[model samples]
Target chain A: MTPITADATSLFDKLWQARLIKDLGDDRGLIHIDRHLLHDLSSPQAFAGLRQAGRPVRTPALQVAVPDHIVDTMPGRGDATVRGGADMIVALRRNAVENGLRLFDIGDPRQGIVHVVAAEQGIVLPGMTVVCGDSHTCTLGALGCWAFGIGTSEVEHVLATQTLVIRKPSSMRIRVEGRRGAGVTAKDLALGIIRAIGINAAKGGVLEYAGPAVTALSMEERFTLCNMGIEASARSAIIAPDETTFAYVRDHCGSPEWLPVATEAWTMLRSGPQASFDREFHFNCTDLAPQISWGTNPGQTIGIGDAIPPLPEPSAPRERASAERALAYMGLAPGQRLEGLPIAKVFIGSCTNSRISDLAAAARIVRGRHVAPGVRALVVPGSSRVKAEAEHLGLDRIFIDAGFEWRESGCSMCVGMNADRVAAGERCVSTSNRNFEGRQGPGARTHLASPATAAASAIAGHIADCRQVAGR
Target chain B: MKAFRKVTGTGVPLGRSDIDTDAIIPQQWLITTSREGLGKGLFSNWRYRDDAFTPDHGFVLNEPRFARAKILVAGPNYGCGSSREHAVWAHLDFGIEAIIAESFGPIFRDNALRNGLPAITLDGAAVSQVLAQLAALPANRMTVDLERAEVTGPDGTAYRFTMDEERRRALLDGIDDISATLAHAPDIDAFHSADRIRNPYYWVQPPRD
Candidate 1:
């Protein structure tokens, strides 16, 4: 083990120090926001607040707005398909035009999920502070940025001042050593970590993912891993930029005059050789299995082959009671196998697992097989660009031939705010982030899994392991 | 937003861990652009049954004893998922002015405070004690005093909690966060100028038509 210096500072500290605009006494600091990403669901209130206050966006050039969350994901959908969402979509466009900010409307080639678009278009950069009205803003932290979600009030604050008054979060480092097993994806690694540590393990702390396993993951995988940081109650999640990160940014951001200088600076954005964190956790993913959430919370997950464990005799009465409640809500008995559990639908999309790589992985599984009878499967790309790329690679043909509904790019079933939703009393295997009760729809049972698992389960009509189904 | 110096109400003991935002306000209720009429959707999944919207007999909030409670005492990590301010709006619409929990999700806590609803965090023992006391005497009221940073049970047992002084003051005075952030305009200008020079590509604009 390498010994850290007394002055060693984690990458989070460096980013924080760089963005600190003013020390507002106490633990609060006014931090400059380099990029502000907005979506239709949460930004309307912020825009209304700004209007009520008679204020204008302080730095319109730094902000970008998109309509993703509540937009319909059907093939021939338009803004009106969002049913009760027309007002929000119209409001977002009106606000962006009024403020002179960039608005990526429904047919724009650059439009996509806010986080995905930010990364793909180089709107989010290393060593910068980014924020969004959505919680999954932390997804951009995979690019070595200090990004996190804010409430509508804070969103208005950032819009009016291009800065936020925030208290510094404590720092924690999660180190995943050893190599991951075959067929294991970043989604499995994230679920495994959340299971080992309870949902609140990193409460109010910034988590920096390190070690060999994390470094070995591709940029898409890193986004998937960090997208769920909020699930663990983390303030933010980040990974230091490396060669893989540089390559991805270069390929996507295009050739700008500042490319050489920016690339050189990004190399220095990583932690020191012996950086120290306030708290450290180490997990070895050598023999880890594909993970699946059995209950409501993301923490209620287990490896694919593992049977559901019985609720423990919690030391606190509240824990015991809540565990029983979750069990009842999930309609699962103790020691039930997650495998062979009948599923009604399968959805493959979200900021978490809707990248092109995720599509390819699922396509590989469903290439020769078809969705089972009585099962409804849907594949939604994260962005229009990703959708175009997947179509170019013929991934859409593979999915459509397999009886999966290939849809337009948007949040889609992940949030259930649009036309896409799971029916009441239905069970769905999803690649989206959260598995909270009624998240997909009222009385809709959601099982969070990786894209491969969701694809394989669509073919099997049950919760099936991708490893066995794909013969990996 | 309502100013919050102190609030006195019966504590509805949710006693459920990781009660997420989705469970608080389901996605179906998120369609409306306005925040009005969200109170009816609060805990709709657990509070109501069937399309008729009949109150569920087993839900804590629907229980006759806690039907009108204005303060919620929940288990650890309450409001754990999503950054939906509608969750906070639902609580406020339902007349909940404060939430006492062992811990809270970072975004949820911020949303609560921004809406002038205090999210008070106490240790596990203190929360457990409060829940137990509330269960024993359903009619007993709990008082949260932001001025003193304390929560008092009906039995006169007081628990001390800590919050950032700035947020505490903001909730007490109903300070708008946007105005507070704008107060540091000069500092923001200084940082932005330097940052723009340091990373020009990020600030560059495409040619306008």
Candidate 2:
């Protein structure tokens, strides 16, 4: 290891300083925003605010808008087909047109979940400051960007001035060492990290993934791992740029001539050999299994073969009560094992696990097998390009043959913004990020898992270990 | 934005941790272009009975005593998940002027301040004390004093809190943040000029469709 030098700076510290438009002192600064992303659900209010205030977009070229959350995801989907989202889509299109901002409308082949679309299009680059109206914007941090989620008010601020005043959040380095077990995908690693750290442990702070396992993940898998940053409510989730990131960037970057120059500069954005952080967490992934959340919260997760532990003792009243209530709402007991717990629905897509690689993984499991009786399974791709690529790979046919509804791209049942909600009083095994009460639908119970686990569970009509079911 | 210096009102306790924005206002209610009437959707799944779509009498917001409460006290990580500022708008429209908690989701914390609602955070013990005090007496009035940088509870207890200096000044003045940043244009321009030279790779905009 290199000796600690006086200038050994962390990745975030370098980005924070590089983007500082004006320092306000006390860890607060007016930072220059490199890219601003807008979605139909949150951009309308921001645009209206700007209109009311008579403010023009300060840097329209740096902004991109899409209608992902509220668009219908049917095969031949149109803007007006969504139950209550037509107005939102129309509003976003109008706002984008008026502001001269780039937009991928409903029929555009590039339209997708803002985070996925941003990374896929190379709009978000290493060491850039990226913000969006949606929390999952942290997913772009997988490419080594200083990216985070912000509210609509901040969105308006960025549109108006291309700047935001923010405090320098503390840092946490999460080290995932060693390769994961078979069938233990990136989704499982994400859930396992959240399970180790509670929902709020890293709130108001940034988290950087390091160590051997994180460095070895495929670019798409890194996106899956970083996508769950919002589940931890982090200020941002990040990984330093490496050759893996540079390879992906070389393919997607808009300016081919700039790749060598950009990659060389971005290589310096990595944390110094002797960098320090406020907090550090280490997890060994060699023996990690496919994780599933039996309760409402993502942190309330256990391995595939594990049973729900006994309720917490009263020493911590809030946690105990929360666990007790989650148990009641999920219709499970203290010792109930997740395996074989029958489910009514299976959703195998989200910004976290809907990439082509993720779809391919699920297809490999359900090639010849059919979904079990009494189960409704759906696969919503994260973007239009992903859907096209998936179809090109013949994964759609495999899924359709296995009794899965192959749908278009958008944030579907993951958020129930569209009409893809799980029925009330029914249980669903989903590959989405959160399992909170009513996250999919009112009174709908959700269990978060990997694409493999979700597909395997759908075939068995219950929660099952993907490794055990993959052979069948 | 409304100016927020001090607020004194009855405290309503919702003793749950990780109260995500989805639980605050579900996507079902986020379709509207306007920000008004969002309070009806605040805690939608919990505050409203599913079948009837009427207020659930058991919900604290539906209770007559807590209906008039302008301050809410909750456990850790209040307003976690989702970057929907609708949660803050719903709280403001619902007459919730301030929130006291152990910790808050970072985005929610900023959202609340930008909208002139101070998201006051106390230590876990103090938050528990406040929740207990409010639950024991639903009629208890609490004062969140931004000027004093503390929360004065029903029993005349004061818990000191911290606030971002710039945000506190902005909330106190109810000024547009854009205007505030414009005041430092020289510094911003200097940085912009330097950034163009230092980071040319980021300046390449994507070609049109």
Candidate 3:
């Protein structure tokens, strides 16, 4: 492989400039999309729009379809398992066949959440431009790719032409220094960052995570970090590709044949010493505790041992109003400790924290104890391959023995699109991304936490810290 | 996409922040492949009272005076959360031609632009003043002029804004994104050839017949 040239620009700029097909001025550019990911919920309308416009997919080979969001994740589940989802599932399958595109259908070994499948199959690589119809597509940015979510109209536009007219977002680099303490994980760090900076801090900007703490995280942990970039309302989130990234991609299924060449190219995909950003932020996770969301939005969070802060005076009207509303919706008062709040259910899966390490973290907590009486617990892997690997490691047995339901892969109970859902009026501790009002279900109260915290909460029937359970 | 030059309509003031798309149109309403009839589902959770389907008169949109409101004025971060375009479709179907907010979610703003609805952003003070003025005079309307890049409130207060020139032209010409993208075919071809050499593995080879 020839030596790749290094540029004195940020990693984002390098990838963005490479994909620019035409600059339309005023920051808007038409960039060629190297990969387009589609799912059952968003792609049906897009495909229908393409058909209505008498257009065909420009590059069918670059597109991959999966039925994750609306598919049932129950064991032995078939296409008809989800109410009102059968049509969507069937439509996705039909569209894939009609367009001659590759699809990881239900029961396929490669089928899983679209983001997980893309990473596991090595389709999303360093320095590539990837777009998807889901907000969590930012997860691919962890692999050093320029990735972001698009609406159905943009999805249709990409289907017709493998390019999108996008405005260049200003860049922000968030540096996290120092080593993380025990019981701290990527989910906790992400929540802590969102709490420190309001949800809109990174709006209209791409966040490049750097520093010792970020580099110390594993590839899956980095995915967990980038997965919630959308929660911060960021255009995307990325990390420079390093040896950890190269090794993960090399070991994943369907890796490219040209490994050495890819590695050499990726080695150059980093920001130079003089690279500048529109804004910069520094966060220290040295003493960070396992974080938890106390209110409806992901930004309304606190460390596990800290009490919820009181709603401040109305001088900052927006903050006061948001805090009051979140408190009302969550049925909590200010200054209350979140630790003893009884939880009716616990979910240990989602695109945010459903990787193998996430399950292992939860498994370690549930190994000897059973879920508290009247509390329901579930463990859903992010992908079918993750499920197989977990079962091979006997993680499923541990979960089941601890009174938790072991389910197949898919976005189960995350968005509540399928039969798996938190019943109305029930409070749940979930490891998913969003904690919006009625996000899990109508009138379902959710407290977002890490996988270990979720498992510990299930055993204690409340929002308990993982350290306490481990101490027991 | 329909061409948009100007729109004049009564503004419905929804003084709320972080109004996510899930609340705009619930996940249950996303069952249809068609974008039609989503207006009925817009804010369905807030519009209706219970399973028996009692109308909630307290909801702002349910008020008789605001029944025909074609403009929506909201607080910051309106249309945050999910990237579902159905939120825009539902608002458009409900006769909303324009939305004025302090800010908007990037994806939602892009979706609105492509769907021919203008998500105009104004400063917080300007939006607050507009909302207060509209609240005092419910019959007063606002005018959004895409050509001039300004919004005129009923009291004749004007808020200036800016948009991408290409998107502005595409919206004015009523041209879909596909047509706009096709105009750059030559440039796209050039980039594709160079990109193929630089990142060969990024391309997925077609399956053999």
Q: Pick the DockQ winner.
A: 2
Question: What fraction of the true interface does each of the listed models get right, in terms of native contacts kept?
Answer: 0.78, 0.72, 0.60
How well docked is model 2, in DockQ terms? 0.72
Please provide, for model 2 over A98-182, each residue's C-alpha lDDT reduced to its tens digit, 9 standing for 90 to 100: 8899999988989988888898888888999999998888888999999999999899999988899888899988988988889
Single-chain TM-score of chain A, each candidate: 0.97, 0.98, 0.97
Candidate 1: tens digits of C-alpha lDDT, residues A359-466: 999999999899999999999999998999999999999999999999998999999888898987788999998888788887788899999999999999999999
How do the residues B11-73 of candidate 2 rate in per-residue lDDT, one tens digit apiece? Answer: 999989888888999878888888889987889899888756788899888888898889999
Taking all chains together, each candidate's TM-score versus the true structure is 0.97, 0.98, 0.97
Better of 1 and 2 by TM-score: 2
User: Where does model 2 exceed 4 Å of error?
Assistant: A1-7
- Candidate 3 chain A has its poorest 10 consecutive residues by lDDT at A250-259
Q: Is the docking of candidate 3 incorrect, acceptable, medium or high quality?
A: medium
- Tens digits of per-residue lDDT for model 1 on B82-196? 8999999999999998999999988999999989999999998888888888888745698999999999986889889999888898888988777666777788888888878
Q: Candidate 3 lDDT, tens digit per residue, B11-113?
A: 8888888999888988888876788989988888788888565889999888888888989999899988889899999999999999999999888989999
Note the DockQ of each predicted structure: 0.67, 0.72, 0.59
